[model samples]
Target: MKDVNFIFIREKIASSYLYFISFLGLITITISLLEIKIPSHSTILILLLIFMGIAEYFPVRFWRGTSSLTFPIIYAMSWQFGIHITIIAIVLVTLIIHLHRRSPIQRMLFNSTQHALSLILAEWFSNKCMHLLINNIDMSVLYENLISLLLFCVFFCFFNNRFYDLLMILLPQPYSIYQWYKKTVTVFLCETFGFSYAALMHVLISKYSVEVNEITVLFFFFPLVAISVISSFSVRIRMEKERLYELFLITTEISRGLTGGNLKHIKQALKGFFGIQAYGIWTKDDGNWNLLLKDGKVHFDISDHSEKFEGISKNLVFNDWKTGTAPGDEIFDSVIRSLVYFPLIVNDELVGMFVAGKSRTAGFFPEDVQSLATFSNQLANVVKTRILISEQEKRMILEERNRIAREIHDGIAQTLAGVIYQLESAQKKYRDKPIDMQQIVEKSIKDLRGSLGEVRYSIYALKPYPTQQLGLKQAIASKIKSLKQEYELDITYHERGHARALSFSKERAIFDTLQESLQNIVKHAQADKTDVLLSYQSEHVLLRVKDNGVGFSLFESMVKTKNEPHYGILHMNEQAEQLGATLQIDSSVGKGTEITLLIPDSQTRGA
Candidate 1:
């Protein structure tokens, strides 16, 4: 629940904060430029600035954020050449790096300003500490500088992290205190490692000649760069693992059912993990493309791009509008500069289409497209399953209508015909035999009462007592009794263990599976006897429906189940999956077909 007023307030605060940071940064840059002096060691200063730029360019990224190896270079310059040169170096490197990243002007200014201010204030504080130490203790100049450098590094790390964390906290998005603490700890560790390297650089510059120090500085950065690259590689590996985990979670959620919340999770994952700005999911129903989920500023109408969607196969289709050569630019909003389109196909039939895009024109990474494609494959199954379920339900409704019609003809219709005959006879007897007419009228009244009872019974049987009133056990018993009475088949119901309460979803799944199984047995089993068992065990609940019937070939039925609308077993299995339960079917020619549903108690329990 994010309210409009809260969003407005957060936006106002963010805007004000960005403006203030940018102004302060610009002022710091101006003052630093005013105090600038071409130092005597200009070559060394140039070399340090170049290294700073390189370090900032290739930052080590983590799941939470990113870190750069620029601290050592910044500290070395700040100690050797003073604040003005260090400030100018930091500002220039920050600008170049941010510009390369296509960052907004406000963000670039804020980043440069924050880094510049942190370093300046930390340097000032460390100088005060160094002066105090020098006055109180009889320490060498080398020791004085070393202590000051350490203090600067510590203060710098603190200020940098504090400013960033404060911004995150003030933003509209959620940022927990626990997450903040973890991020702070991580930043501290990285800074500690960086400053340790800076310490070595400081000692060398102070003790060695300029030529030897410059050479050492140049070669020293090789290992530093190597470390950064290795850390980046590790981060990438970790990120991939995290994505795989996300995929698993998404699959689990969508498998439950087609719901708004499930679809929202997919949309959020795309935006959060892959930086997609716009997306649309469309399912093709009855030869018409219908929008299922959409977000951002996507302008894709299936009607407008029917040919394009029709042409898509197993491969992903994408375009980068920035290239000015990609097709179908009109299908997207101006803000969406790059996009990917994947067809959701199952059983070689296109069931749905997925489209996602980013504002950046560079388009999606290959691996990202691959991951999204796999997700769409999962989504394809769900869409297909939903379609099948809908068809199955429609068929069931028709079958029920036909059954009711037959019931009317067999019971109520015939009973009403008898009542009409008795009424006609009573009308005739009213004039001829008044005594016999009274008896005929009584028989007609009795037949009408039976008809009303039959209608009431049918209505009661349709109620969802499995989840609402009678509970699953009683519902099963009622269903078994109804089947026995209607088909005149020998039916047995047994219950074991103490029945515990189950979630509505689990109960519904079990009941629906049972209904499908019973319907199949009555229609096709050609058996004289049927048995149903409900067992509540310590770990799980089990339901078994067995019929002593002339069973069909299990192998052939499975083959048809895969390709055709064999909803009896297919629907049962789908319900089992939705409940996170297992459905096992066993049968052979001349042997009884047994259908068993096992639901783990952990899944059956209410949330």
Candidate 2:
């Protein structure tokens, strides 16, 4: 940047040959004016000025650089009106060119002066070549002008391009000087061709103005000009389409990366596509936006007044954040200096945003704005989808934890309680019979081992396993088999109606709930018969677990909230709610206990 500013000052200054050949040309003009009087070709000079002005209006821009019919027109003027008059004409053209291009005064002076210097050199060489060729002092008119024009073109192209190349060498460019030289090859060729053709046109117009039939050159020249302009624009348009096609592919790849729930991919994509240094994605959840930024990229020093960034404005892009009227101007300007903010739109509503800082001083282009408008919308949807997935995972974790809690409460805890009761009885009766105490101790050891096995199984309940891959009916039957084997109870399991397809998460909740129910029967029922029924209805799946046991009062257990309430029931209810289902518990002191789980259809569940 220091070198860049130095180069800027060097190019702008007007005193030396270091930055500008134009300065040398100006000095030459002043020297020439002091030594000689003004030449007598005022009419031709005026016409050249008019032509240069007209040519400036529709200068054809090409693949490498911009050019016009003015190049040849000026070359013709330089050869005919002589160096003094031609330099004036060339300067007038430079004024119009600078005005049309909106260049600074320094650029205006440099370009105008450089072109004039090249014209003078080219004209002098052409005259010298003509004098040398005319050995006999009489040559064919066509051959004489053609030879002179050819010689003039060589000098013209060399001086014109090299002068600018020299000025470029004196300045500091981001690229190497050799790279600039390689790039200007096409520019040199185009200007050479243009200068030669204009010279021919000057000869043709001068020789055949009155002879209407001899004006055939105009036909070929006009078509050539038309083709040059048309071809230049066609190539430019085609290249732009190809660039956009590549951009589409790039953006598509970025969209795929965004869908996978990685914030880094999103940041990298947006940064590379927009050619920015940093980006921040802000998404709203329950009316609060969570800001995402790269690690160690931005210092989070802003205050909690982030609500100031609501309601972005729709306006033309402003290069500086402070000058722009985009929503959340402070976020981009005060909190963090960003070049622009691209809004994330979903369903025609502004949902979130991502900001980009320009890699260069020129800032974001309008075409870039249009492209990213569509891109931002897609990004917002990806963020929304990721949030949903993450939340589902969290709910699944919570449901699994609850299921484990219920398994511990119903199985291991109850088994230990019964063992404790037996041990108490043995302690109380130990003084009467030592043999009875030893047998009681053996019974308690057996009870404790069974409880340990159940505890191991409870721990396994917490381990991740695919519940949906195994059918719900088969899974329930497996649980009942384990219960029957462990307790030596006559437990029967049955199913009715076709099982509906459920997501893996939903099946997990249903399976865990059923397991908890069977464990409750084994621990608390103290019954001879236990039955489990799974019935899949048209709109909902119904599961029932019944036990003919010493049933406890549901109201009494539920009312005691200080740790005596049935945690198994509470867990089952939570699992049911998550599945958009209901749990029903029916029990009394003398009657059997029955528990039912009702899971609804997808549509009903969604509601």
Query: Judged by TM-score, which candidate is best?
Result: 1
lDDT of 2 by residue, 231-257 (tens): 666755775685577467656765574
In candidate 2, stretches whose alpha carbon ends up further than 4 angstroms from where it belongs are: 1-70, 76-117, 124-139, 167-172, 199-221, 259-607
lDDT of 1: 0.77
Best of the candidates, lDDT: 1
Number of colliding residue pairs in each model: 0, 0
Please give the lDDT score at residue 606 for candidate 1.
Answer: 32
Worst 10 residues of 2 by lDDT: 329-338
lDDT of 1 by residue, 127-238 (tens): 8887788889997766776788789988888878777777776665456788777777777778888988977865776687334456766797768877877787787788
Error of 2 at 510 (Å): 22
Error of 1 at 275 (Å): 11
Candidate 2 lands at a TM-score of 0.50
